[model samples]
Target chain A: MRGAVIYAPGDVRFENLDDPKIINPTDAIIRTVATCVCGSDLWPYRGAEPIGDPHPMGHEYVGVVEEVGSEVANVRPGQFVVGSFATSDNSCANCLNGWQSSCLHREFMSTCQADYVRIPNAHGTLVATDEHPDAELVPSLLAVSDVMGTGWYAAVAAEVKPGSTAVVVGDGAVGLCGVIAAKELGAERIITMSRHESRQKLAREFGATDIIAERGDAGVARVKDLTGGIGADSVLECVGTSEAMRQALHSARPGGNVGFVGVPHEVAIDGEELFFSHVGLRGGPAPVRRHLPDLIDRVLTGRINPGKVFDLTLPLDQVAEGYRAMDERRAVKALLKP
Target chain B: MRGAVIYAPGDVRFENLDDPKIINPTDAIIRTVATCVCGSDLWPYRGAEPIGDPHPMGHEYVGVVEEVGSEVANVRPGQFVVGSFATSDNSCANCLNGWQSSCLHREFMSTCQADYVRIPNAHGTLVATDEHPDAELVPSLLAVSDVMGTGWYAAVAAEVKPGSTAVVVGDGAVGLCGVIAAKELGAERIITMSRHESRQKLAREFGATDIIAERGDAGVARVKDLTGGIGADSVLECVGTSEAMRQALHSARPGGNVGFVGVPHEVAIDGEELFFSHVGLRGGPAPVRRHLPDLIDRVLTGRINPGKVFDLTLPLDQVAEGYRAMDERRAVKALLKP
Candidate 1:
C-alpha cells in the first residue's frame, strides 16, 4: 500500500508502506475509495506542529470494507462505509451521551490516505450505506467523516436556531461547510469572515449572507454592525488561532454562543474577559460518530452538497501535491482518490 | 444616612453618609429593610482586591421604596421591593434576550449597606412585592436579590435538568444556594464540595445528596467516582478563584456544563485543554433581574429559605462587625439590619 508520510516540515513524500492489518477483534481493514488532506494536516506539514518520527497522515475517508475482525458485525466485507476521524465504541457512557469523540475507548484515525487502512472500533465507528450511491456523491460522503461532520458540530455547539444570526470565522473548508450547516439549521443570516476571493464566493454560495474581510477587532466591528450593535446569536470559530477565537467571542451577543472546532494552538482565554462577555462556549473534536447517520442521509438525499469544498482532486499517489496546493492556498481542499 | 465604607483593607467603618437622592428619571430611593455581607466583599476586605479610596459598600438589599423619580412607575413609594445588584433597562436587547446583567444601560449597586440607596433603572430592576411580607420572610426575600438569584442563574446556565447529576463547587452562601437551585431544577443527585462542617450540614439541608470535602484533584476524583467515572452532568462554580474554576471545569463530564457565577479574580484557561475536554462553559454575573419575580415568589411561598445562609445578624451601624465576621470566616454570611 502507498501512503503520504511527513518526514519534516514541507517534506511530505508518497512512499510504499506495509498494508494495515486488524490488530483487535473490534477492528476492520478498509480499502480506501476516497480520502483527503485536512487543514489540520497543515499543522505538521507547515512545521506549526511538531513532527516527530515519520508517520502516515490523514483522518478522513469514505471506503469499502476489505475484511473485518471476528467481533466486528455492524460493518462487513464489501460494504461501502463512512467513518469519523475519531472512532468510538458507540455504547460507552460518553458516546451514549452523544459525545462520541470523547468515547472512553476512542482512537483517532490517521492512516486513511492509503490504499488500505485499519479501523479500530469498527463495529461502532463505521456506518455502512444501504448501497453504494452514485460516484459523484463520494466526496460529500467522505466529507461527512470529518469536515462536514465538524461543520455540523460547530453549528450545533453554537446553538444556531431558526431566524437567528450566525457568524462563521475562518474561510477554510470547515468554515465553508459551517456556512452550509448554519443555513440548513435555519440561521436567518449567515456572516462569514474571509479574505480569499475564491473561498468567499463558495461561502456565499453556501448561504453566507454577509462577509467581513477584516480580521480581529475590525472583523468583530463588522459583525456587530450587521447584528444590530450587539453581535450574532451564534459564532462558529472554524479556525484554531487566538485571533480567530477572539473574533468569535467578540462577534457573539451577550448570552449567545461560540462553537469553536479548530484545534487551538497556543490560545489562552482570560477567564474574567469570558465571564464578562456572558458568552456560552463549547468546542472539541466534532462528535462526528454521533451525527454520521443523519449527515450521510443528508448527503444521499441531495439536501446538501458539501463536496463543493473540494476544489482540487488528485490521485492518491500524488498526495504530496494535494498537500502543497492546500498549503499554498491554491485549493480550499484536495480530494484524493485511492 | 449611615453606611459601611471601606477606607482600606480590613478597615470597614460605619460612617454618616449623605442621603441618596434620585439622580435619574428612572431612579428610586429605597429605605433598606435588609442588606447582607457577601462572600465577594471578602475579596477587597482581605486585600485581594485594590481599595482606591473610602467608598460605600454592599450590593444586596430588600427595601421599601421611599421615593421614586417622575418616570418610575413599576413600584411606587412605600412599596416593598426586591432588587438585583446589577440594574438593567429591561427593554434593552440583552435584557430581552434574558441577560439582564449584560443590559446596555446596566449599573451595579454599591451603596446598599446604607440606610437609603438610589437605584438606577428602577423601572426594570425593582420587583415590588404585593405587600410587606411577614418578618420571617424578609431575610429570605433579601437573599432573592442576589445570592438566591445568582444560584438560580447558575443552575439555569448549567442547564440542570431532571434526573441529571449536579456538582456545586464552593460552600459559601451562593454555593449553598446552588444546592437548593439544583434540587428545585429536578437534579436527581446534588454533590457539594465543602470542607467546613457547618457548611456541609447546611448544604445537606439544602438538598445536597452528597458531600465531598476533598479539594483539587482528589475532589475531582471523588466526583468522578460518584458520577460513574464521567463526572457530574452539571457543575455550578460559586467560587471565583483559579482553583475553583479548575475544579468546576474538571468536575463536569465531557459535554456537561459548568455554570460559573463567581466573579473570577485572575484566571486564564488554556484553550486546547478546554477543547479536548468537550465541556460547555458559561459564566458571568448572574442575571438576577431576569429571575427576580420568580425567585421572590419562591421565597414568599416558602419553597426555599436561602436566608438560612446568614448566620450572623447585626445592626446597620455595626456594619464593620459584619465585614469582620465574614472576613475571618466566623460566619457564612452576615445580615445587616437598619
Candidate 2:
C-alpha cells in the first residue's frame, strides 16, 4: 500500500509501505476511502513541530471496515464508517463522559494515510452509517474524523445558545465548520473573521451572518459593533497565535465564553486580564468521537456538506503534493483518495 | 471620625478623619457598627502590595445608615444595614445579570475602616434584616458584608454541585467561609488544606469533612486519593499564590471547575498546564452586592455563621491594633467596633 510518511521537518513523502493488519482483538482493519491533510499536520510539515523519524502520516479518514476483530461487537466488516482522529475504548470513564479524545485507552490513528490501517478500540472509535451512501458524501464523512467534530466541539464548549452572537477567529476549515456548528446550535449571529474568499464564501453558505476582514483591534471593534458594543456572547479561537487569542479575548462580552480549540503555541494568559474580563476559557483536544456519530448523520441527511473545505484532491501516491499545496497556501485543505 | 489608614508598609495608624456625607442622590452615609480587617488587607500592610500614600482601609462593614440621599428609596436613615464591599447601581444590565461587581456604576468600598463612610448605589449595596437582632447577630451581619458574600461567590464560581467533592486551597477567613458556602450549595464532601489549628477548627465547623496538611503535589495527591484518584469536582483557590493555583489545578478532576477568589498578585498562568489539565478557571472580584441579600438572609436565619473567623476584637480607637494582630498572623481576622 502507498502511504505518506514524515521523515523530518518539511519532508513529507509518499512511498510504498507494508499493509496494516489487525494486531489486537479490539482493532479493525479499515480500507481508506478518503484521507486529508490537517492544519495541525502543517505544524510539522512547516518545521514548526519537530519531526523525529519516518513516522506514519494522516489521521483523518472515511473508510470501510474491511475486517473486524472478534472483540468489536458494534461495527462489522463491509460497513461504511467515519472514525474519529483518535481511537478510543468506549468503556473508559472519560469516554463514558463523552470525551473520547481523552479516553483512558486511546491511540492516535496517524497511519490512516495508507490504503489499509488498523483501528484500535474499533467498537468505540468508528460510527457507521445505516447504509452506504454514494461517493459524493465521502469528503464530508472524511471531515467527521477531525475538523467537523472539532468545530462542533468548539461550539458546544463555547456554550453557544439560541439568540446568541458568536465570533469565529479563524477562517480555515475548522472555523468554517464551526460556523455551521454554531448555526446548528442556534446562535443568532455568526461572525467569521476571514481574509480568504473561498473560506469566506463557504462560511457564509454555512450560516455566517457577518464577516469582518480586519484583524486585531479593528476585528474586535467590528465584533463589538455587531454585538451592540457588548462583544459576541461566544468567541471561538481556532488560530493558535498570541494575537489571535488576544483578539478572541477582546471579542467576547464580560460574561461570555471563549472556546479556544487552537493548539496554543507559546500562548501567554495574563491573569489580570482574564480576571477583569470575567470571561470563561474552555476547550482542549476536542472530543471528536462524541460528535462523529451525529456529524456523520448530518452529512448523510444533506443538512451540511463540509467537504467544501477540500479545495484540492489527489491519489494517495501524491499525498506529498497535497501537503505542498497546503504548505504553500494554495489549498484550504487537500483530500487524498486511497 | 476615627479611621484606620495605611501610611506605609507596616505602618497602619488610627487617626481622626472627616466624617463622610452623602454626595449623590443614591448615596448614604453610614456610621459603622462593626468592621473587619480582611485577608487581602494584610497584603498591603505586609508590604506585599504597594502602599502608595496614607490610604483609608477596609472594604467590610455592618453599619447604621445615619443619612440617606434623596434618591435612596429602599434604604432610609437610622437603619441597621449590611452592605457589600462593592457598591453598584441595581438598575444596570450587568447588575441585573447578577454581576454587580462589574456594574456600570460600581464603587469599591475600600475607605470603610472609618467611623463614618459614604455608601454609593445604596439601593443595591445595603440589605437590612427584618428587625435589628441582639448583639450576637451583629457579627453574622458583618460577615454578610464581604467574607460571606465572597465565599458564596467562590462556591458559585466553582460550581459546587450536589454530591460533588470540593477542595479549598486556603485556610483564611474566605476559605473557611468557602467551606460553609460549599456546604450550603450542596457539596457532599469538602477538603480543605489547613496548617493552622484555628482556621482548621473553623473550617471543620463550617463543614469541612477532610483536611490535608500537604502543600502542593502531596495535597493534590491526598485529595485524589480521597476521591478515588479522580480528583475533586470543584476546587476553590482562595490563597492568591501561584502554588495555591497550581495545587488547585492538580486537585481538580479533568473537566472540573476552579473558582479562584484570591486577589491575584503577580501570578503567571501557564497555558499548557491549564489546557492539559482541562480545568476551567472562573472568578474575579466577588459580585458581593449580588449575593448580599441571600447571604444576609442566611445569616439572619442562622443558616451560616461566617463570623467564627473573626478571632480578635478591638474598639474603633484601637484600629491600629486590629491591623497589627492580623498582619502578624496572631488572629485569623480582626473585628473592630465603633
For candidate 2, lDDT tens digit of each residue in A25-79?
9999988889999998999888888887679888898888999988998889899
| Model 2 C-alpha lDDT per residue in residues B40-60, reported as the tens digit of each score | 898888889888878899999
Per-residue lDDT tens digits for candidate 1, residues A27-67, read 99999999999999999999999999999999999999999
Cα lDDT tens digits, model 1, B1-338, are 88999988999998988989889999999999999999998899999999997898999999999999998999999999999999998999999999999999999999999899999999999999998999989999999889999999999989999999999999999999999999999999999999999999999999999999999999999999999999999999999999999999999999999999999999999999999999999999999998898889998899999999999999999988998888888999999999
Judge candidate 1 at residue A234 and give its lDDT: 98
The residue pairs in collision within model 1 are none
Model 2: runs farther than 4 Å from truth? none
TM-score, every prediction: 1.00, 0.96
Q: Which stretches of candidate 1 lie over 4 Å from their true place?
A: none
| Top model number, DockQ | 1
